[model samples]
Target: MDLLFKVYPNLNVEEVATETYLQERSILSARNDDVATLNELAINQFPGELHEYLAADKAIEDDQPIKNRGNIGCPIMLLRNLQPRDGLCNGTRLMVIQFATRVIEAKILNGSHVGNYVFIPRITLQPSVSETPFQMARRQFPVRLAFAMTINKSQGQSVKYVGIDLRNHVFSHGQLYVALSRCTSSNRISVLLGNEDDDKTTNVVYPEVLL
Candidate 1:
């Protein structure tokens, strides 16, 4: 996508390994699926062989086909709070440095522990009963590709260049503002509003909230 190239112009170059390059850019979208799509696209452009990690999902009669794919030098976000005191909190971002069968080696890219290498082991995860129709357990690394993340997930992250995929209108109040503000400079933000002729995006603002 043109948006991907504009926001991460060095993804296909040697600068991809630089800390500044890895941390200063990101793509945000309203939908999780759209975010995943953009993440895959960006990683595909990254210079490395594809490595796939399959999830072991178990449920009464249902199975979740969850798979994660990435390679060394790709950015990933922590899905669970493994160690908050050490800065391994949920939503912390890191770049993959090495991968083994049972664990992964990554360098922290955010927060107080930025630049520290840490080992992440695969962990068992269960969805809350109310969140799923059937009780399920999934065993997999608690990380996801971070080239792109949902607008809600991008809440605390600030980046230099941001590409917002607005093909799907933001569904929550302040979602548009969150995505737009993630970028340090207004001129460094690019947005795709679905159609070539569309120029406006819906922003949900309640007058009472402003008051």
Candidate 2:
């Protein structure tokens, strides 16, 4: 948001210069009554706090979610599943084709949909699970800048290159594996490990079930 607005043409209309379609009223449900707000907040809030907390505890520092204000020609990732036949999916990568105050036109950069143009519209979304609080749903644009994405979000997608920085060691299960596997081959990875940590102490993961 801050970066997108600063670096790209803010397509938000003057009448609705709001970054997210959700308002404060959207954050208080657990049955997906406010999906967009929950997703945005989930992207921006707890994960960030967890990252800082982990950094404070000497865990990974580079795992925080990116909030990019999308710009023309910049890359982006779809935040939700959409038209698969035209190559749009949960983790599809794309390039901005055109931007309107309320609509975004993009070209597919990944999957079978590569080279295709897509018109993304505001959507309603809900979690498959209902056991959690704030399981609310809301409607909004379902995209995020592709400068970087969280490991949780990066699953099932293959990228050309992978960079792993363990400045703060990985804190969750399988984060290392997921990060490593995102690249098609080992030759495409570049890892930065500080001098003080042993390799074994760094690529930490849980014992059994994991992502």
Candidate 3:
């Protein structure tokens, strides 16, 4: 949040607070107690808002990741293929230097354009997911903070160093391989594994998808 204040200086990033669940997860009090007890034993549990939101019936109806509150000096990833020569191509990492209602001023953090400040314009965007009803179109700068990213988004790009958290496992084919291949060599990559109880803590591949 400090980054947001440093960049915008005036804009407020209202905390998306946790709301109460509309319905109970279980009718039995014993089951509720059991869940509460288990949660006490869990590490790094999901955020309360996220837990309730995912449990809601229409979670996907308004499901767009929060983007408008980016802080200044925070690293951002370009979401559209733009100005490759200027090093503003999709998946390129940059730093937010200025934020505006309509335009964004950022400095390229990686590649040939490193240390270069550039202006980004708003563009029309549509969610490609079939489940997104209404097919709404939004005009906004196509960018997301680069503090975290999906392996799919990092594909076709190379980095000097890379980190892979395999705690959640690969939900699709080739994700593990794509993540490992992002850096120049094994020496440049670091993998984070989960404990034995984490069922999703394994590298996965789907040969059929590659075929």
Candidate 4:
């Protein structure tokens, strides 16, 4: 929590909507659940009327409903390649501008389409699961809150202020390096470790793979 505040202070300030302001900062974490929790906390602190959108989910075999959600004024990442030519590809970051029953209005934060406003409509997405017997499809605006994102998702994005949640030690090769390098300056990067007594965290390395 303290890490989040250190990275993104003054959420209510008018600069929150500026493209440069949103583009220059982000929080990185190793786990999806941790990222979601941090994103939720940051959204709740943002100055905006809360708007919620429920996804229409269905099991491909049984038409069963699965619940997913989104909100307005929240920073989000495109989950699918909506349009590559326009730069609305997967991992593109954007800020929600408006919400309707079936579409979301957002401004592109980075990439060639930066500052461009676009409308995102609901789309059907099916996950490939070899272990599960039944396949499920979710029809929703293809985005997820991104105030805090997984270290994997943070790849290819450069930010000025980066906060890394390292309470759960990194378990993949180069995960720590990726998180640390996202920031342009070492001094601008802040990491949260398990305890004050230790400033160390695991960085998984395969010795044979290196040699």
Candidate 5:
């Protein structure tokens, strides 16, 4: 993922001036790295969480659960089902697995979805293609997306405000640049652990990449 981010530096919004922060609050309030907070939010709202314990009759009430779209809260589980579709010579089903830490794993589940799954190979570092334990599960059901994290699809996209995990190892020069520069001004950006010293090696880099 680091290599991919480096190669496509322009894909992520690096200029804060372009973002729109609809919610005006401390950026930490967003808690981009708090896995516990995200789990709480998901369990509180998702259909399967604690519903059975709350008023059995009310819980059984026939009502469509609200669908989550747009910027999903962190620590989300994305499940994608891979099915073949006629379009590509190599029938590959599309499956994208993205981690909260911004690592992504994409694979071709079946030949039909090959076209849809091509984006991953084109943009990111390719993971080894093979049948594994995950394939066994995929064979039984349609697997779309899964997993949870503090940051969701919002990481590289333009946003009004952003919360970043500044743990030294996670804060690479490119990451710091991307996270801090997402907001328009310094005031618009907030770091949870701002006191830590920046790693000198990661902090200093070739200036040309910044361009």
Candidate 6:
């Protein structure tokens, strides 16, 4: 199970280029260039409203400083739910809180189950289990949700403000574009950084064409 943290700046401007290019080109490109490289470049230079929106989104995810909104509006919090997809532990119930914050802490009632409030730590606070219950439980306690998300889940949603967690290395360029484009305007986004290492990257650019 992976935990998402909130640590990014706001989504200030719309990256119009990437969005327009993606619209013109399908996500599946014929070229073999790493998608991250293309996203890093194309998103910044592409020319279009959507591209600009996506670029701004990428910028924010990269930890560029932006204005901060005290609170987010209509913010949809997401968690990576872990259930066994295969054998032995297959179908076992487990969940990982990807993003952890005081707000989430309060909302989840300190790992208390929302449906029954049974205080079942394994169900509410534990991560996926593949070993001894104690080991899993130990691992679960440290599995704090502290990573930001890419735009994968932000699409088709409207909100006045957005908080993104861009600390995870697994986040791809496509996810960043999707996350940033969700914002309608510059002032509507804010990004949080969970660690200093997350602050090292620069603007993302995508390849102009698959080669």
- The most accurate candidate by lDDT is 1
Better candidate by lDDT, 3 or 4: 4
Cα deviation in Å at residue 128, candidate 6? 20
Candidate number with the higher lDDT (3 or 5): 3
Clashes per prediction? 0, 15, 3, 0, 29, 48
Local distance difference test, candidate 5: 0.30
CA lDDT of 153 in candidate 4? 88
Native-to-model Cα distance after best TM-score fit, residue 34 in candidate 6, in Å: 25
Error of 3 at 173 (Å): 3.4
The residue-by-residue lDDT of candidate 2 on 1-211, one tens digit each, is 3222221223233323222211100111112222233234333421111111111111123232323354455456787778777777887877666676566798777666567788988665556776745344545568865544566666766755555544446667667777777777777565545568765445565656653
Error of 4 at 164 (Å): 0.4
Please identify which of the two predictions, 1 or 5, would achieve the higher lDDT against the true structure.
1
Deviation in angstroms for 199 in model 3? 11
Q: Which ten residues in a row have the lowest lDDT in candidate 4?
A: 61-70
lDDT of 3 by residue, 120-183 (tens): 8887776678574456556667775454466676676666555555544566666677777777
TM-score between candidate 6 and the true structure? 0.28
lDDT of 4 by residue, 103-131 (tens): 88899998888989998888998776656
Roughly what TM-score does model 2 have, to 2 decimal places? 0.55
Query: Which of the two candidates, 2 or 5, achieves a greater lDDT against the reference?
Result: 2
Query: What lDDT score belongs to each candidate, Candidate 1 first?
Result: 0.88, 0.51, 0.51, 0.83, 0.30, 0.28
How far does residue 177 in candidate 2 sit from its true spot (Å)? 1.8
TM-score of every prediction relative to native: 0.92, 0.55, 0.56, 0.90, 0.33, 0.28
Kindly report which residue stretches of model 5 are placed more than 4 angstroms away from their true locations once superposed: 1-128, 131-134, 139-156, 171-173, 194-211
In model 2, which runs have C-alpha deviations exceeding 4 angstroms? 1-68, 124-139, 194-201, 209-211
- The positional error of residue 25 in candidate 3, measured at the CA in angstroms, is 40
Q: lDDT winner between 2 and 6, please give it.
A: 2
Query: How many clashing residue pairs, candidate 2?
Result: 15
